[model samples]
Every structure is written in C-alpha cells, then in structure tokens.
Target: MLISALLVLHVIVAIVIIVAVLLQQGQGANAGAAFGAGSSGTVFGARGAASFLSRLTAVLAAVFMLNSTALAWIAARDVGEPGSLLERIEPVPQLQEELVPEDEEDENERDEDELDLPPPDSH
Candidate 1:
C-alpha cells in the first residue's frame, strides 16, 4: 500500500518535471531580446519563470530518484512475503526416501524401463 502510494507520487513528480522542463525557454530564446524584443517581453520580467521552473524540475527529479530507491528497497525487503505470485508460491520440500538393496534393484529396473523410448523419426 505504501509502495503503491509512493509510485503514484513518483509518477506525478515525473510528469511535473516534464511540464517544468517544457515550460522553460531555450538558450537562444533570449538572443531575440537583444534585437528589439523589448524589456517587457516576459511576464516575469527577465528570468523569473526559467529559474523557478528549473529549480522545480531539479527538486522533482530528486524526489523521483528517492521514490524509485524506496520502491526497490521495499520490493527487495518483502521478497519472501506472500503477496506477489512468486512470493505466494511456497516451495515444496523434498522428502527423504529410505532405500533398501532389494528396492534399489526394482527402482533401477523401473527407471531403465521408463527411459526406453522410440526414436524421434518413429513419430
């Protein structure tokens, strides 16, 4: 449950990071301002939106990385717990069979009989 919540948060942060990066202006975008784009070009005056978005992207990236690490840690820690399909499956323990000399001879004969097979071309 905690992991699920964390995963959702991580996804949200990743999306926000994408949005934040997209919102920022490119390096050459400011070159136009030198030509005559005017001092009132941006709503933030100069570098307000870019600085804010870049900082936001950086913070969200850190959050995404931390959440990923947490999810991995939880999955590894709960590897043996009964939740997932692999975890729910309990391995069947092998039983020790006592063998006698007489039993061994009969078992060997049965094993040889089981191993007897026709060639693949016989099919």
Candidate 2:
C-alpha cells in the first residue's frame, strides 16, 4: 500500500515537471529584442522564469530519485526468500526417491575409475 501510494506521487511529480519545462521559453527568446519585439519582457520579469522552474525541477527530480530507490529496495527484499521456483506445488515425500533413482554398483565403479592418457610431448 505504501509503495503504491509513493508510485502515484512519483508519477504526478514527473508529469508536473514535464509540463513546467515544456511551458518555459528558451534562452534565445531574446533574439526578438533586436527587432523591438520585446514579448519576452511581458511573459516574465527582468530576472526571467529560470529561478522558479529550476527550483521546481530540482524538487520533482529529488522526489523521483527517492521513489526509485524505495521501489528497488522493495523489489530486492521480495527476491531474498529461499524457496523453489515451483513452491506453490505440494511436496510428495514418496515420489522423491522415484524422481531420482539410485545409481547401480557398475555405474559407481565406472565413475571411480580414472582415465590413463599419454603425457604431452614438449618441444
């Protein structure tokens, strides 16, 4: 529940940041000043809208980082359990031995025998 809530908040902040950035004007907007088009002056004051947008972008970015970390931690915790991939299937003790048959004596002897090979010739 906590994770879901945080995810929602993270998405909201991301959308807000994207919209705010798109609405803001670019640096070269002052090129119109040469033609006396001065529309930039009316949209935002002399200092410009950088301060407000920068602060908002910083806040939203911080929240995005924090929520990403939290989600990763939650995912890591959930994978740390010790169990088989098919844990939902019921265990049958009687079938265990049948699943893996015991090795015969001849097979064991073959496994114990070592192979003899000629030594490598050195130049």
Candidate 3:
C-alpha cells in the first residue's frame, strides 16, 4: 500500500517535471534579439522564469529518483516463493494404440515354420 502510493506520487512528479521543462524557453530563443525582432527583456524580468522552472524540475527529479529506488528495494525484498512453468501446465491425455494387420503377422509365422532343406543330390 505504501509503495503503491509512492509510485503514484512518482508518476505525478515525473509528469510535472516534463511539463516544467517544456514550458521553459531554449537558449536559441534569444537569437531573435540579434535581429531586433525580440524584446530586450522578459515578462518574468531577468532570468526569473528560467531559474524558477529549473529549480522545480530539479526537486521533482530528485523525488522521482528516490521513489524509484524505494520501489526497487521493496520489490526485491518482498518477493514470494518461485514457481515452475511446468507445474502450471495441464497434462495431455494418453492416446489409444492402433491395431496391427493379421496378414503381416501370418507372414512372419510362415517364414519361421519353413525349414531349410538340402538341395536334391546332383547325380
């Protein structure tokens, strides 16, 4: 129960971290200033938005890492007895034997019954 709660928190923080990172502007965003197409200042004032977003992202990331480690530890220590794959499978039914032909058996008997006799004396 505790691990499950932590997992949920971890997922939520991860999503927030992603959103925070995406919301921040890239370094290249300032390039517009070189062509005078951008404002010399930001609405957040100097470095305001960047610093706040970066700090939030860092904190959430740390929490996410700690939660992941806790989950791994819990899983490893709480595992139950191992089971075999063969034990879960159902046994197959035995097949009936097919009948043999009578003629084949008779041929074997006849071969055994015949006795080897010497050829007639060559006069």
TM-score, cand. 3 vs. native: 0.55
Q: List pairs with backbone clashes in candidate 1.
A: none
- On the 0 to 100 scale, the lDDT of residue 64 in model 2 is 86
Over 4 Å off, model 2: 34-49, 82-123
Model 3 agreement with the true structure over 16-57: per-residue lDDT tens digits: 999999997776676666566666575333454447888898
lDDT string, candidate 2, 28-50, tens digits: 66666646666445433256445
lDDT, candidate 2, at 94? 75
Q: How many residue pairs clash in model 2?
A: 0
Candidates in order have lDDT scores of: 0.78, 0.73, 0.78
The candidates, ranked best first by lDDT, are 3, 1, 2
Query: TM-score, each model?
Result: 0.52, 0.52, 0.55
Quote the lDDT for 16 in model 3: 98
